[model samples]
Target: MRVVADWARQESWGVRLEWGLAGARALGPGSACVVVVDVLSFTTSVSVAVERGTRVLPYPWRDGGAAEFAAQRGAVVAVGRRSVSEQQPWSLSPAGLRRAPAAERLVLPSPNGSAISAAVDGVPVIAGCLRNATAVAGWIVRQGWGTVRQPVSVVAAGEHWPGEDLLRPAIEDWVGAGAIVAALARSGAGPLSPEAAAAMAGSVGITDIPTLIADCASGRELADSGFAGDVAVATELDVSAVVPVLTNGAFDDAR
Candidate 1:
């Protein structure tokens, strides 16, 4: 950590693509921005909500109080994948959120993405995914983050195995993070670490994102859970202009 912390401070626009909370710490307090990529649902859900003119509050999934937290914030809570129905408009299902009526504010609790985003304290956190990767990168550039000075950290919110305390590498979040990395590289926004560079290279061959993601382990798991549509929505590239910026503990459209 001392080595990583030292490395982060050396560059004018240093960026290290890392997973979970460790990534946030590596970038330290001087980071221009922290982009949280949870492509399977969380960041994609943020895109949908922000596009619909709703602010999303990323609440970490705790014991079962997300509903109460939602009530406290005067926002609707998103249910689990299987618990969603027409009446429960807000849910983790990206497809369901797209079709359901939008609430002015949505409180979404997730074990992966939301938790990672919430853990990154004292930094500007923005949700990014395939749907708004380019736009998010563009916004970062426009704001002079990782451009004129300061650094940015792209945090990939990887999936945790069932009943396990460790995270399994997820292809979807990797690819999603790569999408943003590639965009940032093209803009010459900052210096990319080897891991971020490799991620960008991996994304270069993705000619058919939806097809590839459809067969990934997470995709298959979601399909088994009757949420295949969520995968499809997550693969939509550069179609959304909304960049969900988190400030004061809520995500609203950056534009």
Candidate 2:
């Protein structure tokens, strides 16, 4: 199967473009695998959780329905937010998430990532970030072994939309996506779409990975809000090889 670079560019290929998580969620259930990218940190959080051996339960930021669902499944609920508010000093950590009681949960209300997951319910969802890009790509390739087609959608959780400024988010997500595409190509999965190829090429210009991340809109927002360290940590690739797979609305290691 072919890959769609950004949702916006999917229209010509008869693929629907999902603007935000809401749009993504509208794409009902199927055999497709939705890969969500919140390059700034949320995706990083999922990678971290998987690496630490904690299962991730994703939900829509606006709706808390996933929280109850996770509780029923005996998984922790994690929250994602555009910026950390006073109410949420620490977004759930991988270690803390692992310690959550069976009936307990971590709620994620991040700016971009969590919403991406909420949009595509019932579809096999995977978390993607620069840090875990290679691992996740490897997992996808393995999953596609012997299959005629692998339906995969890479959702770029760009910065808050309609703001018009996209330099940081664009650069961050393009780089992350590029790494994944490279990994997939290396696995003999075939070539990426032209847009994907361009993104991969663009990632090379980011000489200072950490600095680039920190300067991103989301990164700057997080840093200004006291989450600067998180930005740096998020930019690191392959820090953890855990590939988080979303099953029935929760994220678990893809054993």
Candidate 3:
């Protein structure tokens, strides 16, 4: 094997906050657990689907043969947020999923969150969003990661820049992650890392979440694209009791 090494490895053994796949890999190996925050709208959709009694299989993307992936598992693949119809019912809209009849499994695809999720295996992963932040954190604690005080990595699945490979950090996801970090510390799961602490502080800095999220870059982008309802649904706080944990590569209600 040819010797090939590059970036310096910065690993975390305590609660840490990281952005995107690089962070996920840095903190994932042998870590206690991971909380993937993808507010618009992978985890949000997961929260919705799991709450409605359906398992979500997060495919890497809608293209790249996602249909084949779903078909192989006998699951229904979700289409674009606005692509919903009587024949094609599932979509990326959290609110719409709430109204749709629950299915056995759904192949939810996304460029950010699902990719992050698919990258991490052998570690307990929970889909975190504004709607279910508290519940997910509380669930992590109840799993003994809190009492024993193991490291919990909060990974933000950020948005990609338009027409570029670079990931753009979305304010909504930062705030959503902040909510989870704060909840974890509040529940005495463990003390937050400096980065995580700052994120939690940021989450607390915003009081008017609905208004703030609506005005954010990602939010406005979604709104401009006619997904305002999705932004609204994702901004709801602590209204969910469902914790979508990945089991055997599929997210299901672990509550």
Each model's lDDT comes to: 0.84, 0.60, 0.85
Of models 1 and 2, which has the larger lDDT?
1
**What lDDT score is found at residue 121 in candidate 3?**
72
Compute each candidate's TM-score over C-alphas.
0.93, 0.74, 0.93
Model 1 TM-score is: 0.93
Q: What ranges in model 1 sit over 4 Å off? A: 1-13
**lDDT, candidate 3, 1-255, per-residue tens:** 222233322233356788997778777765688899999899999998987789999878735898889899988888887788887788888878887878898998888999899889789889999999889988888877743247789998899998888989989889999999989988886656778888999999987988998999998998898879899999888999999999998998887
RMSD (CA, Å), candidate 3 to true, equals: 2.5
Model 2 agreement with the true structure over 33-130: per-residue lDDT tens digits: 66677776677777766665555666655565755765677654555433234443335433333343332234555546776775565667778888
Which residue segments of model 2 deviate by more than 4 Å? 1-19, 22-32, 64-105, 145-148, 161-170
- Residue 235, model 3: Cα distance from true site in angstroms: 0.9
Worst 10 residues of 3 by lDDT: 1-10
Of 2 and 3, which scores higher on lDDT? 3
lDDT of 2 at 98: 32
Per-prediction CA RMSD (Å): 2.1, 5.6, 2.5
